[model samples]
Each structure stands twice: as C-alpha cells, then as structure tokens.
Target: MEMENMIGLTDLLAAAIRAWKQICVTMLVFALLLGGYQGYRQYKLATDPENSPEKIEERYQAALEDYEKRGEELQKKLEGQEESLASKEEYREESLLIKIDPYNKYITNIVFSFSNIDESAQLFRYPNTAADYLPKKIRSQYLELWKSMDVPRDLADGRYADLEWKYLNELISIPALEGELLSIRTMGASAKDAEDLAGAIFAYFDGHRDAIGRSSAAHELSILNQSTKYVIDEELKTKQESLDKEIEDLKTGIEDTKQSIEDLTEPEREDGYSVTAIVKSVAKYVALGAAGGLFLACFLVCCWWIFADRAANSFQLERSVGAPFLGAMKPSCPPAERLAAAVMGERRWRDPEQASAYIREQAEAGFPKEGKVLLLSTLPEGKAGAGMAGLASALEGYAVTSVLDALHDPKAVKAIQDCAAAVFVEMAGQSRLTDIRDLAAQVEGAKRPVLGVIAI
Candidate 1:
C-alpha cells in the first residue's frame, strides 16, 4: 500500500519535472525584463551630467578653486587688522556685555562713545573725580561726599591750593579764563610777578602733557587705520565682484557643454538601439540587445514550463486509476506521434478493461496461445505498470497475481516468473528511470511474448 501511494506521488512529481524547462524559461524571461529595465534606467541617468562622476568632479573642483581664491583675496585685504579684531576672546566678551542689557542707556552710551578710546585713558578717568588724587582710604570718603554734594569741594579752603598744579594750569589755559586772568594781573600784581605766576601755571600744565599727547595721538592713528581699511575693503569688494562674474560665466559655459553632451549622446529607447545611428553603429557589436532578447525568451519559456508542470501534477491527481495513458508529449517534439495515436483511438483509454480486452483480442487473432505470455512493464515507480497488471488480472481464465515486494528482495523478479502467463510490472514516469524505449526493448526481447506496454 505504501509502495502504491509513493508510486502515485512519484508519478505526479515526475510529470512536474518533465515540465521544468518551461518553468525555468518563463522565470528567465521575467528576470531579463527586470534587468533590462534597470539597465535602461542606469543608462539614462548616466547620460545626465548630474549623475556622471567625472562631470561632478569637474564642478566640485571649480567651486573649490573659487572659494580658495575668495579666501586669499579677503586675507590680503584685511592683512594686519584681521589678527587683532578677529580674536574669539574679544568677540565673546563684547557679546556677553551686549546680552546683559541690550538697551541699558549708560552702557550703550559709553560703548558707543568710547569703543575706539585708549584703554589707559579710560581706566585713569573712569570716575572723573578729584578723589583720584587722594589716598585710597581717604578717596572713598571724598567720593561719597562728592556724590551727595553736601560739602562743595570748590568752596572749601585749601581745596583750590591742593588742586594738582598741572590740572589747575589746564583750567587756566582755557579760552574762557583769558579775560579773568588779565584782570587779576592788572589789579596790583607787578608785570614780572604775574608773568612768573602764569609761567609756573603753564609749567604745571606741561607736566601732565604726556597723557594728553598719548590720547590725541592714539585717536589720530585710529582714524588713519580706519581710512586705510576702508580703501582696502573697497578694492577687495571690486575684486570679489569680478571673480563672481567670471565664475558665473564659467558655470554657464560648463552647463552648456553638459547640455551639448546630453543632446549628442542620449540613451536609446526600448528597442535596444540608440537614437543616434552613429552610437548604435559603434555599440552594435556588443550584442547587448540580442543578449537581452535571449534572456527574455528564456524567462517566458520557464513560465510556460511552470504552468505545464502544475497542469501535469493536477492531471495525475485527477485521473482515474483505471484510465489508460496517452503517449508522453513535449512541446518541441513532432506532432506525428499524437496524430497517429489519435487516429488509432489510442490517445487515452478511460477504461483499462476495454484496453486490455482490445489488446488480448488483437493478440489471439494474430498469434497462437503459446505466444500469449506477454511481459508488460513500465519504468521504475510508474503507475502505468500497475494499471496494466490490474487489467491483465481481469482477463478470462487467467489467474493473475501481482508480486511487488521485490524492492527488498532482488530475487523476487525470478520467483514471480513461475506463472504460465506472467506480466512483470516495472515502475515508470520518474525522471531518473532508464529510457522508456530501452526498457521496452529489454522486456519485449525476452522469450515470453510481450504483447503491449504503457508509460505513466
């Protein structure tokens, strides 16, 4: 029973195997179509400048050169000043102060007025008070009093005398003090004495002259420095503008060149030939289109094979156990065999008993009873043999018995041959079995009269 079931299954799988070529060819066709589509897409993308590595590299180089040139020009324009003003630490400190109170009037006013002021001068006159001349401990009290204006330092005795003579001289030299000093000199002081006093005052003022000169010189130098920066900045701006224009022109030219290349060497259409005849001529020898066609054809053949395989498997399962087999067919083979079978009413027999009776009648009509011992056989694992055996057993006056346990016992074939009219049933329809024609010859050539044979 297990053997019969396995034989049925094997017959089914063998039919499917016979159709494997068609299935493989179909799959190959689909694979080729997919591969062709991908190849065409790649070709189109490559023809465009944006996707071409060489073109991309060329554009990148041009951009890099432009950037480098701009950097060099900027460096030359702001040579010395860049080092001083471009320090990160200076910018960070300035940014911190700005963040504290962006609209604080005192800070805004001071920074705006004195951003260019000498650092030393700013430190010395930050408070701008007389307390700056006093000792630190005493200066604090003086500063407190000054803020309150409780005791005016100008009205106090010895305040005028204690004033630094250099500071006092600076006050005296003011244009507003000229007339008052002249009146004081005329009021009873001698010319010589007045002159000496004025001279002493001038000397006192001269002692503090270093601070004024340094402040004035620094301011003038800052102005000169800014004027120079303005001139260089303008020159650099003009150069940058010129370079920008040139770069634009070059980019336009590059784009035009790329467009021309695309127009001249565009990708081909689905027919596997380029639009440009010149390109096609050069590339025709590569046989790219032929290769693609071959792949598509094979794929289609594989699909047909798979479809046929499924049909064959279904046929095996649905077929009745007593049905007679038509001859095996292949798409590539000649149709003569099928035509012959059809004309003889042997294409397929639905009733195995009718087929067996027909065979027996034909044999008895032609040959003697001594020649009726027909040894019918099939390929190993073939259902055709079992069907034949069943038909043979149903024959009149013939005691038919099937012995199929030979798979385990090699000598079983000899043991079963003792019967007067024996039909040795060999399996069939498996891919690895011996050739049908070869097995037929071997069985029929035996001394027994082999009447008829069938393949699953």
Candidate 2:
C-alpha cells in the first residue's frame, strides 16, 4: 500500500516517473516557444532599417564628420590660445614691471629756483608775491627745453636700449610750474646713469641757456641742485608680480584646454557579426525556459496529486474514510501487448471475493445473514463502474441491494435503514477521498455501521 505524506521524496519520485510524459511535453513546448521567439527577434533585428548597412554607413559618415569638425574647432581654439599667450608674454616682458630693475634703481632730483636781480638766493622771494611769477616764467621755458631735449631718444641705442616704456617714462619726467620751486626727478638703471642723466640735463640747458635767457629776462637763473639718491620702484615691482601671476594662470588654462582636446575620443561602432553568439544565446534561453517549464509541470502535478483528494491505496483509503479496508477489484488495466505491459505500466488489484467475504463475515457476527446488504457508492449511476455489479454478483447467496451516490438517493436512505449493514465501494483516481469520508460519516450518522471500504 502507498503510505506517508503526499510530498514524501520517494513517493513524489514515483509520481514524477508515472507522469514523465507530461513533464517532457511541457519542457519541449516551452523550449520550442522560447527558441522560436529568440529566432524571431534575431530576424527582426537583422531586417530593421536602422541596422541596415547603408544606414549604418551614413551614420558613421555623419559621426566622422562631426569628429573632424570638433577636432578642427579645437585646433583653432588652441591656435588662438597660443597666439594670445605669446602676445601676452611679449607684452608682459615689455610693459609690465618685469623688465624694471627694482633692486638696482637710482633716482636723481633736480631743483631749479628763481631770483630777482636784487635778492641773492632767497628761499622765498621777499613778500613772495613775485615768487610765483618768477618761477612760472622760467620753469615753463625750462620744461620746454627738457621735453624737447631728445636725450632719451639719443641714448635709446646705447645704455637705454634694453629699457621698456614703463622704465623709460620713469627715466624722464615733466614737472608743473605751479609750485614755489621747480623740481624734476628721474629714475636711472644705476647710480652712474643717474649722475649721467643729470649731467645730460645740464648740458642740454647750457646749449639752450641763451634761449632760456631770451624767454625769462625778468627772472634770473638760480642754483640747480643735482642730487642723486638710490631707491627702488615698489609700485612697479608690485605690478610685475601681479602680471606674473596672470601669465601663469593663462599658461595653466592653455595646458588644460590642450589636454581636453587630446582626450577627445571618436564614437564607437559595432564592427563585426557572428552567428556563434546568437546561437549560444538562443540555446541559453531555451534551456532556461525548459527548466522553468519542467519545474512548473512538476509543481502542477504535485498540487493535483496532493489536493485532488483521490484516495491512492488501501492505507490511504482506510485513514480518510475512517473505516476498515477490505479489498479492490482485480485487473483494472485495459488490454495491452505483453511488451507494452512489461515496459510501460501496471495497476495493483485485490481479489473481489476477499472483499465480499469480509462483508459476510461482518454480518455474521451481530446482524442477520439472510438480510439484504446495501452496496453503497458516491459516483453517479452511469459512472459507477460494473465493478459494483460484479461484486454484487460475486456474493451469490447474499441478498444484496446496490445504490449509487447513496447520500443523494432517497432510496439509499430507505435501503440503508432496511439492510443489515452497508459496504462502501469506490474506485481509485475516480472517487474522491473527501466523498468517501463524507459518505462514511453519513452512514455512521444513520447508525448503520459501515462494514468496510472496497477500492477498485
């Protein structure tokens, strides 16, 4: 007899073997469906306009053109940057204080004072009212001589050749004649140059001394102070530092842009084709589908086996119906060739005579033996197989009465009341275990003791 819970490993294995055809068919169906879908997808991809060779080539050409255009723009940008950087470098060297001698600078101060013919070297002209007029009259002529001296231009090829405009501007200056005295200052590359610039100023004045006298005869020429002092150009030095920092920042930006242009990459394109990968992919999907279908089929079979509630064997039947098991019909399988019978399947059958004998034996103990025995079943009259009739015929001497679906039959109620005892008859795989249980309850509830269950 089959025994244990529905999911017991050994029993489940046996059930799977019995239902192997269903599992195989499910797997085959799933594999074919998945493989067909994969092939269809591959064919669709191959036929798509977007994937056509001409379309792909057109896209490649567009991409290549864009790439070349980007490269050209980058090159132009780099050229512009380099040009700007070079021009800035030249300007920074020439205009910024980088070319100025901050540490080795020399300054000279020249002060010219005016005097009346009667006042001898007066710090302030007596009353000071004539002081402004005298200085202004002479200094204006003095400045004109200084600016038009051409001293710097004459020295430009010699000692001042390396000096930029910022430095050259410091080397000479034009003073206003709005003060008490006239003071002009000049910066020089060295102490010697400072003294020499002061001398050049004096020499130019000496040559233009007649012109100076002709312009300001009302004012007298006074002592000139040519005092040379050593000092640094701090403001120019600060500007030079600032310009250096800007040049460094520009250099960094150029380098970064250059690196970015270098790092630019061309778009990627799929280059080759192969059926090997496609075949492998299809195989993988088919295998996975088959495995899934196999598991699903097994699960369905297991659910039907467990919950369909069809009593499997004598042990299972007795427990479900709560009645003693007698026996089942013999040779229930249909005819088959010997080879098929041996190789494919078989059904277990119990002797029907044994079941009949048990019912008789139950009646002999406590009930009348000659009375009719109710042969009760839960199947409809038509589907309740000939096995019930055959069992009834097998009990030759007993007065037997057969009823189908006894729970629903009014005649079964009367027969069950008159009969000496009742025997439950059901076929495995066709009769439900729950029906047998309910029927057994109904019989016991009617106070007609159930003799036993007979499974065919």
Candidate 3:
C-alpha cells in the first residue's frame, strides 16, 4: 500500500520547496504587516506627547503647583481682611435693621449683656438708662422690685405717677446729665456758659423727655448710616474682584496647557498613510493571501496523493493477472461462477467423495456437458483483477483468464478470445461494475458461454 511507504524528511522538504511560491507570499505578507503595525504604533507614541508618560507627569506636577499657589493666595487674602470682613458684615446687618424700623424706640438702646442665663434667650429687656443713673447695688434692688410688681393700666393715676417718678428720676438723671455735659463741652462753654447751657438743656428735657430720647436714638442711627455704606460695599467689591481674578487666572492656565498639548500632537495627514489605515490594509491583504495559499496547497497535495496511489495499484494488478487461462470459445463468464467452482473444487479435491458428489449433482441437473472447462474467478480484494485469476488457477481442471482492459492494459482481450469460458471480475463496488459489465456483455455475445459472478 502507498500508506506503507514512509514519508522522509527529504520528501517533506521537497514538497515544501515545490510549494515555496505560496509559502513565501504568505510569510512575506505576514512579516510586512507585523513590522508595519509596530512601526505605526511607535509613530503614534512619538507624535502624541500628551499621551507620553513623561509629559503627563510634567502636566500633573504643574497643575499641582498652580493649585497650591492659588490656595495660598486665597488664604493670604482671607487672613489679611478677616477682622475687617467680620466688622463690615456686622455693621451691614445693624444698619439694615435700623433703616427698617428706626422709630421703634427700644431698638438702639437694647444692649445685650452676658449672664448665666441660656444664651439663646439672652434678648431680655432692661431699663434703657440703668447703665447711667443708679448706683450698681441700688439698681439691682430696684430691678428686682420692678420685676415683682404687677402694675396694670387701670391702677389709680396718683399711685401710678408715684412709681413712674421714682423709676424715672433714679434711672434718667445721670444719662441726661451726661448729655448736658457733652453739649456743654461741644459748645466750648465757660462755667457761666455751662451753667446757662445746663439750665436750658434741663428745661428742654423736663418739657419733653421722651422726645429727647427719640432724638438721641435718631442721632445714633444717622451715625451708623454714614459709616456702613462705604466700608461694607468697598470691602465686598474688593474681595469679589480678587476671587474673580483668581478664577480667571486658573481658567487661563488650563486653556494654555490644553493648547500646548494640542500643539505637541501630530497634525492629521492629508495624503500620507494614517497608522490605522495602514494596519487595516496590511491585515486584510495578509489574511486574504494566507487563506488562498493554504487552500491551494492542500488541494494540490491531496489530488497528487490520490492519483499517484490509484496509478500504482492499477499497474501492479495488470502485471500479476495473466492471460488466456479460460476456455477459448466462450470468453465471458461471470467471475463468481469461477470462484464458487474453485472453493468447491478445493474442498472436494481435498476429499474426493465430495467432489464426485458435486459433479454428479450438476450432471444429474442436466448441466451442459460439451466443455469440461470450469471458469474459476472472484472479485479482487485489493488489486483490480488479481483475485479473479488467483482463485481460478487455484481450482483443479480450470484454466484461469484475467482481463485488465478497463483501467489497465487492454491487450488481454485477445488472449481472452482463445479461452473456452471467460470470467470477468469487477473491483471496487457497484458503481465501478458498469464498465466491467459492458466489457463482459461484448465478450459473452461471442460464441463462448459466460459464467456466473464473483463479488468482494
């Protein structure tokens, strides 16, 4: 068998050399694609510096420094104006309250004093003049007595007037005297002038004490109004401008960095090959070429192997099966008749009684007695016509004739004409038997009686 012929290294090498065109094309395409892809990747890395590790680290460091610098500047600005900022904010709130309810008389004189009471409820009322007129101990006792009383409006006028005079005289005197002194000082008055001024102030207070208190409150409100507007507005504007400038500077820095990165990037090519386009093109050609080369190589090798094996076996069969072994007149007998005769005859020749019995049975059945030729043949197991001739020759008193004209030498047909009976063997299977049958029919139509078939 062709399979028994071992393939050597030399044969494999020869086959590869024979297929070198396809292999070289495939390998060259692959190598070029790989090298081109690597080169393009390197080009991309070289061009896009923003994508580079060194540039990225540098940008990160720059951003960190800028952030720290901005933070420090903001901290310094905040530290420099901390007290002023708080004062301006407080003044703005006080000014707004005074503007909203200026004539509500208790507003300005309501001083908040710290005590052991809960700080959340510290907004308690006190006599407006208590800080000025009475001695500290006496004022404490008076406030305690006032708190204990429950004076209602329907009380007798005399009784109410008595309490009111006591409270007013004790609390209002010192504050009114302080105001008179301030007026006297402002007028640059001598003793005579002070005394005269004191009389007039006292007379004015005596006539309209509540009106004087209201006027004093209005004066304090005017002072707060004059100062708060300029200070609060200017401070807020300055801080806001500083913050806006800082934000604008940070944005400019970011934009500048982004522009630098864009400048460092490679510009798009108009006509030159792009890395992505080159890689895709190379891959496409490589895949197409490799596939075509592999398929062609496989197909050619398979065809050569099949044809070579078939030719070799046909040659061997033609050489082994000899000619003119069957009887001459009837050159076409089916090979099975010959093989049955061979097996039966071999069995009978080994035992004469069986052979005689078989022959006697055929004779009794009125089989043809004109020729003693027993065509012995069989379907070939491996070679095309070898088994037919081998089996026929193995039978006693049988001349074997094997023909190989279908796919081998056709000269055996003339030798088959001289045989008394011809046996035809068809190899392979049913599909292959058509040609064998055609040949058999031609031979059997001649004067010779053809025998039965043998199949394997």
Candidate 4:
C-alpha cells in the first residue's frame, strides 16, 4: 500500500469553485431524474382506491388527538411544578420567623421608662369615661405606633445592610406596651450589628419622646437597662438553606420543561385532500428530490477534490510554498471552455493581463535591484528553457530570466540561494503535486520566497 498524502483546505476550496457550474449541472440532472421518478410514483398513489377521503379524515383525527394529548401533558407538568414551588415558598415564609438570626449568635435588649396613667386607682371604682377612657386609648395608640416603627427599617438598610427588612424585623423582639416600663430586643450577624440597631431604636424614642408623650399620654423616655442574650437552634439556618436550594432547582426544571414544550410544538392540522391534491403532492416530492440532489452533488465534488494528485489551483500553490499566490495564467481553449460548460465549468477565468501584471509587480517589489525572480518548472531543463523562450517570443512584454527544473537542475538550488523570489510554472495536467512539494521544500530550506504559480 502507498503512503497517504496530506491535503490542505485551500486545495478543496479552489477545486470546488473551479468546478461550480459542473456541480450545479450534476445537481440539475439528478433533480430531474429523481423528480420524474417521484412524480410517477405520486400519480399512482393519488389514483389508488385505498386512500379514500374517509381514511385521510381518520388520519387527521388521529394526529389531532396526539397533538392535544401532548399539549395536555405539558400543561399538567407546568402546573405541577408551579404548585410545588408555591407550597414550598409558603412553608419557607412560615419558617422565616425562626430562620433569620437576630444577633447572628448573640442578641441585645434595651429598656425604656415611659409614664402612663396608673390603672390600679380604678380597682374598686366603676368604669369611668374621663380618666379610664383617655388612658386606654393612649395605650392602644402607642402599640400601633410601635407596630409601624421605621427605626428598624432604616437600620436594616444602613448599619445592617446585609439583613433584609423582613429579616431584621423578625430578629427584633418587642413586648406589648402596658405601663411605664418598655423593653426592645435586637439581634444580628455580629454583637456590633445588634448594638448599633439597639442604639438607633433607642435614639428614635429619645428624640421623639416628648411628641410621643403629648400624643399618647406618656410621661418620660429613658434607657433603664442594656443586656445581651444567646440564640439556640442551629438547624433553622440549615433548614432554610435546604429549602432555598430546592426552590431554585424546581425553577430550573420549570424553565427546561417550557423549552421542551416549545420544541415539541403541536403539528399543523391538514384540511381534506382536494381533486388536484395529487398535483400538489407531486410538486412537493419534486422539491424534496431537488434538495436531495443538491446535497449529493456537493458530497461528490468534495470527495473528488480530496484525492486528486495534482495541485490544480492558485490556492494550492500558495499553500505549498507558504507564500502569496500571485495568480494562474493559462491560454484559454474555446473547445475546452465549451465542453467545460457542458460538463463541469471551465476553471475560473482570470484576465491574462491582470495575472501577468500581478506577477511582475510582486516580482519587482520582492527585489528592487540586482535580484533575479527564478522561474522554476517540473519539465526537463531543455523543455523548460524552450517553453520560457517561446512565451517571451509570443507575448509582447512578458519576460523570464531563465527557466530551470527546480527539482532536477543542480543550478536551481544555487539560484534559490541567489534569487530574491521564485515562481513555479506548472504545465496543465503534467506537474505532479509531489514534484511541486519537493521543489517548494528546497526553496523554503534556502529561505527564498515562492511568489506563486503560473499554469501553462
């Protein structure tokens, strides 16, 4: 078995473009053949007595049932996920009262003395409207005021920014107002968090005490005591964390199911088949045939290009020498061009003047003075020399210093060391990729640039 050779993407791409019209033609031919075959088949199927309207209607009913069944399943799954999430959230809120730590580990309490009417004086007296009524009303008002307190809310946002309002509010424990003595407890992530929050609450009552006394029949406001307490129940934090993770996972599942529902969307419902339904069916099959043909044609073109021995295009020339491909210049044959259009498409056309000018400009630019641009070929030394001479004699201004078989001529290696750059002259259907590669390696080894290729 022979060793395999490496093929470049440049080779495959150029080959495809060079034969685009041929690929298109192949697809057209296959499309016509397959479409005609499908048309005949569809015509037979249309006339078949087996496919009565009743059968087609039955097919529609079955498809509709399947669609509806699938939709119902998705809706049920979505509802189930929603219900589960809501139930878990409700449980989570209920547990939040115990879940949010007040002082993180330690809690603080501050006490205040506020004056209110002594109800002991009315122990023996019947309920009186004057003293009894006003004091009772004042007590109720004070409770409401504490319920709507904003000190804790402000502290939650500022000093204890990590704690949510609900959490911070939960962390604090307040007693019902009854007499002169009032105590408020606060807790947080650190002892400082609790102390700061307690201070803020105390400051609110102190600053607003006179107003509170006037509004609620209270006398004095003072901090009587300050104490710290420890909180127990390590499991509350763990329980809350577990609940949060579960809720998040459920949400992700719900989103995935939504995507699944979208992907498995209900199929379209078809109406009854018509008298000309056979014609429509035939056309649809023909379109499918054309699409199939295009796919196969591309597949064949790719395969042919991969295994071909010759580096036929300018792109491959560029890849071989790792240099800029100036362009390919070859004399056009009318018969060959015509045959190519009928078969593949002739190699992509490039104007000869543009091709030659590109070579000259690049060759001149590579070396401004006293530098030869070596024109190398795969042919024998005599043949290569004669070919270049004939080109110079025929073309008005096209010139070559010399032509040498870079792989065979000993002088070619020396020239590569001497010349500024080189260009390969590849004869159509003759220059092997192996020969070009060998010559390219020699040039590259000598550190000389290969400008590009010229195809004769």
| Model 1: per-residue Cα lDDT over 205-305, one tens digit each | 33433444453322211111100001113443454455456545555555554454444432222223234632444344234544555556544544543
How well does candidate 2 score on lDDT at residue 69? 93
lDDT of 1 at 242: 55
Of the candidates numbered 1 and 2, which has the greater TM-score value?
2
lDDT of 3 at 248: 59
Weakest 10 consecutive residues of candidate 2 by summed lDDT: 337-346
Kindly indicate the candidate among 1 and 3 with the higher lDDT.
Answer: 3
Candidate 2 regions with alpha-carbon error over 4 angstroms: 1-25, 46-284, 334-347, 350-368
Candidate 4 residue-wise lDDT, 166-223, digit = tens:
6566667767555535677876556776777777776765666566556545555556
Local accuracy of candidate 3 as per-residue lDDT tens digits, 114-157? 12222222245365644432223222332343344332222222
Per-model TM against the reference:
0.27, 0.42, 0.21, 0.40
Worst 10 contiguous positions by lDDT, candidate 4:
340-349
Q: How many residue pairs clash in each candidate at the backbone level?
A: 23, 0, 22, 6
- How much lDDT does each candidate structure score? 0.36, 0.67, 0.38, 0.63
Backbone clash tally (model 4) = 6
Best by TM-score: 2
| Model 3: residue 297 alpha-carbon error in angstroms | 9.1
In candidate 4, the residue pairs with backbone N, CA or C atoms under 3 Å apart (3 or more residues apart, or in different chains) clash, namely 22-344, 102-187, 102-188, 103-187, 103-188, 104-188
Give me the runs in candidate 3 sitting further than 4 Å from their true place: 1-389, 406-420, 429-437, 447-449
Off by more than 4 A, model 1: 1-48, 51-347, 350-357, 363-378, 382-397, 402-412, 415-417, 421-446
Q: What lDDT would candidate 3 get against the real structure?
A: 0.38
